[model samples]
Target: MGEGVTVSGDIAASSDIRIDMWSKLGSRVEVGGNAYLGEFVTIDGKLLVEGDLDVGKEVKIRGGFEAKGWIVVRNPVPVIIFLFLYIREMMRLGKGEEIEKAVEELFEDSEDSQDFEGKEPSENIMIIPAGAKISPEVIEVAGEADIGSNCLLIGNIRAQTVETGKNLTLKGSVYSEGKIIIGESSTVHGNLFSKGQVHIGRNSRIFGGIKADSVLMHENARVDGTIKAPSGVSFLREAAEKQILVEVNALGKGIVSKARELPKGVLQDDLIKAPDVAEIVSLIKSSAKAKNGFVPGRKRKTARTQALERTRRFTGARTYRKEKSGD
Candidate 1:
């Protein structure tokens, strides 16, 4: 990993574990192959390595270390500087394809797809950006996983919670301790398990089943396997705002569903404010209604667009009358 790695808990890698300078590793670290640590690094717990160990100046392993292979204590070069030097040599030799091949290998995650699946949570999250080249590999994150839109993840995800943007193609299961909210038009090829609620957005497809405390699904969403929710399942065929309106309207007796009473900030977002259900309930009690030609839950059209539509209809009628008179 590069600089500024804030690692907590033990880290186990099937291959080499290379960390840059001035980083703090809070706990134990176990590596299957080589271990390369940069200068001024601190390891609070024990370190166990199966292969060679390389460390720069002032790298402290407080709980000690065990290595089966050679141990070298010298000034280890930072990864970025090493990469720059590597590419510079290739440029001097007039070879360019080697650099592209090296980059392709790193992004493809051929090494990340190894026996790194069931390691302890890193207390960090792996963010796969949209359109990044990543191979299918099972990954575990201790924190929330926020996947970007249209990215293809070919592995199962286990984390505290999982949220995905639209059009994501995931070929694995999602297991979370908290809620799971998937965006519209995404596809999950495996099962979903959550300790809390699960919300599947519009037009999404889950090839496997879902199990959670509660399940909220869109009307056109498809799940190939069975869905189980102890708290029950609710379908939202419309926008969330409209769905709330429908629910409030349905409660003629002024009863509110327990699911709507989640603790504040439980469903918080940076860009969007969580709905105030109480205010909506009060509106329902007050019989809030729109007046004259105005429709609730429908987006308003521009005046220019409306005028153009009206003119098109008038022109069609005029053309029809002229054609009949000529005949």
Candidate 2:
């Protein structure tokens, strides 16, 4: 219970078995009733619990975990890795030849499709529906793509333009010649490279760098890595940085040159005053955020409702109805 012990075979307990720290069970651990695991307990085989299983952190289950009731996993890497391997194996079993043949048949009927004699089929689009599971392989689409939500794609996607729905998880890179729109709560574990603009929704997480002509990001969006954009966007960031430099000079009591000021071509509106260093920093951050299409003070719901009301008022039911007396 308190000390370390190494057992070579299976251990079956009718009641509860408590395996403490530094204890190693080389084989299967079967509890006819309930089990409690402390820290650093290693079970090399399957863990079967007929009843409740209370496991502490750092408990490693090398084989499988089974419980008739509720089970909680503290770490998900093992599960994710296991599932990925299993899916890859299932996708590889006797499916490659069938898929290849199907693709060949589809291409053979290309003469009937769109009647293109010589030119490459550049207008075909691929749609990945919601709640779909796809392996990470090479995906090439010449036209626009609409990828739905709750999908797991483990491959690179090369398309002309790509639009994704919410909660999409992609484990590979995405390259688009045109605009790329990513939905909310989605994750791209690899780099996103686009020849055009990239728009990301709110609460989305990007684990890799984003390279595009321009990037539009919503509030609360996180880019874990770098962002590369065109000269204009870079100019804005540089301007913000220059403001910090100006602030630092001001703090040093140095003469700020008129040439240090931003050109009127950069900012059209009247310059706002930042009272202090903190305010200057905030201003810089706000400017950077605004460059990503996230407006600081605007409420999305209020704006949407106002727009709907205005539209309703502008397009009243009388317009559609025949002008009774005027006719």
Report the Cα lDDT for candidate 2: 0.69
> In model 2, how many backbone clashes occur?
2
Candidate 1 error regions (>4 Å) = 1-137, 239-327
lDDT of 2 at 90: 59
The per-residue C-alpha lDDT of model 2 at residue 46 equals 92
Q: What is candidate 1's lDDT per residue for 1-327, written digit by digit as tens?
A: 545455555677776788877777888899988898988889999999999999999999999999999999985357678888999999899889998899787669565454444553332224332212222456566666777677777778877889988998989999899999999999999999999999999999999999999999999999999999999999997654322321334444334555655455544332233344453333322223543454556657788997999999999999999999999
Worst 10 residues of 1 by lDDT: 126-135
As a TM-score, model 1 comes out at 0.38
RMSD of each: 22.0, 29.5
Residue 212 CA displacement from its true place in model 2, Å: 0.7
Task: State the lDDT of candidate 2 residue by residue for 98-190, as single tens digits.
Answer: 655654764594433563334333322222322222223655555666787777777788788998989999888889999988898999898
* TM agreement with the true structure for every prediction: 0.38, 0.32
